[model samples]
Target: MLSEESSTSKENIGLTSSETSTKPRSNLMASVELTGFADNGAGTISATLGNKANKDIAKTVITQERTTDGVWTCKIDGSQAAKYKEKFNPTGCVKK
Candidate 1:
């Protein structure tokens, strides 16, 4: 009787292990973009990703330049933008 009980307990433990399947949480990558240009230079941008897993994981890649005349100028790949439509804010220079 003792041997049979031990064998049954081992089989039950094996069944329980196969029925459980959990996934581990992975590290996610996110970014935060901010700039001094928004809405065709009609506003200033101060955006954030807000409360991420880590501060270093959140990145900011702004591509805008402010002039002495209070004008916001943007450039992409060292070229002028006629109608910028990228992921970053300010959307290049908006030459139109």
Candidate 2:
């Protein structure tokens, strides 16, 4: 039973007595990185994928499209090709 005092509690703010039928629940933060982002999905999906790529990637030719999802491609510099011939990915790997 919800007493008048309990009904107005800050925790239940913006909720109504009818809404009280369903108790409130907590949510955990979700994150993802790279193609190998957890192979298994979460029970409660709450991922925050950044829509913008805040990167300054430039080379012989820089091609990008909004429709392209998760796939980031970059042209290899002609001069640097030899140094990155056996690199990991097509864009060449840079260890920080």
Candidate 3:
């Protein structure tokens, strides 16, 4: 016969094991777009990732130019050159 304390400990251990086993791996992706304009005539944009751990994984820049008609055109530079290295857990696999 199992004591009440032993039974409770077994239940706790089982719950913890199940919780850890059921945790899904992270599926992360990131994208950036120009969202607004700055006071210095520069475009203000933001880059974000699905995982907070990847927020600072890359550097970005915005470029703006004035046309002959006094119109400003904004674009995202360094975007195409950005690279992402995806990481997988347990085995610590890295995919580029």
Best candidate, lDDT: 3
Q: What is the per-residue lDDT of model 2 for residues 1-96, given as tens digits with 9 covering 90 to 100?
A: 112233322233322233343221312111221122223321111122122322222111122211124443333322322233224334442221
Residue 58 alpha-carbon offset, candidate 2, angstroms: 13
**lDDT against true structure, model 2:** 0.25
lDDT of each: 0.31, 0.25, 0.33
Model 3 residue-pair collision total = 0
**Residue 95 error, candidate 2, Å:** 18
What digit string (tens of lDDT, one per residue) describes model 3 on residues 1-96? 111232322222231123324221323324333322323333333333343334434333333444444576444333333453333111422221
Itemize residue pairs with steric clashes in candidate 3.
Answer: none
Write model 1 residue lDDT over 1-96, tens digit each, in one string. 111232422222221112231111222212222332323434232222213434432332223465546786554331222332344335344322
Write down the RMSD of all candidates, one decimal each.
Answer: 22.8, 17.8, 20.2
Candidates in descending TM-score order = 3, 1, 2
Clash pairs, candidate 1, are none
Give each model's clash number.
Answer: 0, 0, 0
Global lDDT for candidate 3?
Answer: 0.33
Model 2: lowest-lDDT 10 consecutive positions: 58-67
TM per prediction: 0.21, 0.15, 0.24
